[model samples]
Target: MIGRLNHVAIAVPDLDAACAQYASALGATVGAPQDEPDHGVTVVFIDLPNTKIEFLYPLGDDSPIKGFLEKNPSGGIHHICYEVDDIVAAREKLLAEGARVLGNGEPKIGAHGKPVLFLHPKDFNGCLIELEQV
Candidate 1:
């Protein structure tokens, strides 16, 4: 099962501009950009009182974000991440309940360095869902 809302991920064509918009215009605290080669993204986290906003940009030609940006040049919300107490157990429960897990049904190291798995968007009302073990 899902726990607290971890973070909302947004794909942005320009990382610096997006960070500036959040930092200067919105007066938010933006964390340093981190390159996640495995995920093919360069990310910047906007810290908030309750939850975080993740700004992601494509890292390579084959980056998924690149495809997303191509579809929507302005960029948009890519996914929402929710915390889970146990990823393996959660995966099992989801599978048993007829939910489709993305990527071979295995957890990968996320941006937070935690085990993470992505679920099919169609299974979650057209919004991509990411489950991260906390």
Candidate 2:
């Protein structure tokens, strides 16, 4: 079952600028960079009260975030990540219910070094879904 709302993932054109904006606006302290090569993003986490916020930018031309930014010039919220206790079971349940998986069958290391997977937006009312196991 999904646990807490882990963090909200936001795709930004410039990670540093976004981090600064959140810090100034919400008094959030920016954490160190987290490189998720499997997801093709390098992000910084901003600590928040109930949940954290992630600022994501492509690390290279081939990153998915690069394509996302190209499609969304101004950048936007990429996905809402919900924390799960068992990612394997949650993935199976999602698939069983006909949800499309964004990534391969294997769970990849994600931001904060947790196992994570993304569900396709087409199956989620155009809202990208991220399931993270902590």
Candidate 3:
């Protein structure tokens, strides 16, 4: 049902600063940053061997990450995305198995330029899960 670790989203206060830090510390080149207004955040991706890391920051106070930051101040891992070959089938199978979906049955453009959907954490052992078709 799962493919690979697509990315690990880390909520940060400053996307640029976080990207720079990752670049300097891990010698990772940051990809172009993208603003996902629909999701209320912006992101910069750093590709790795088998997975990638996404630096996300709130676009405004209404952003979900903003609330996360309010709770932890210094933000942290927001969620983990797994690449899947068939999102619709996977989603349907998950739903049939009693997984709660965070959104309606629609795939939205994700930070990685792929169609994505979020599965409720309640269905994933308290770990927020993301499914991306890439």
lDDT of 2 by residue, 22-125 (tens): 77887778987888776688989888878988888898668988978999988999899999999999999988999888757678877667898989988888
Stretches > 4 Å off in candidate 2: 35-38
Q: Alpha-carbon error at 20 in model 1, in Å?
A: 0.7
For residues 39-117, what per-residue lDDT tens digits would candidate 3 score against the true structure? 7888788888878888888885688788887886777888999989988898889879988878787888876568899
TM-score of each: 0.97, 0.88, 0.86
**Model 3 pairs in collision:** none
Model 1 regions lying over 4 Å from their true place: none
| Alpha-carbon lDDT of model 2 | 0.85
Q: Pick the candidate with the highest TM-score.
A: 1
The list of candidate 3 runs beyond 4 A from truth reads none
Better of 1 and 2 by TM-score: 1
lDDT per prediction?
0.94, 0.85, 0.84
Q: Kindly give the stretch of ten consecutive residues in candidate 2 with the minimal lDDT sum.
A: 103-112
Query: Which pairs of residues collide in candidate 1?
Result: none
Task: Give the CA lDDT, 0 to 100, for residue 118 in model 3.
Answer: 94
Provide the clashing-pair count of each candidate structure: 0, 0, 0
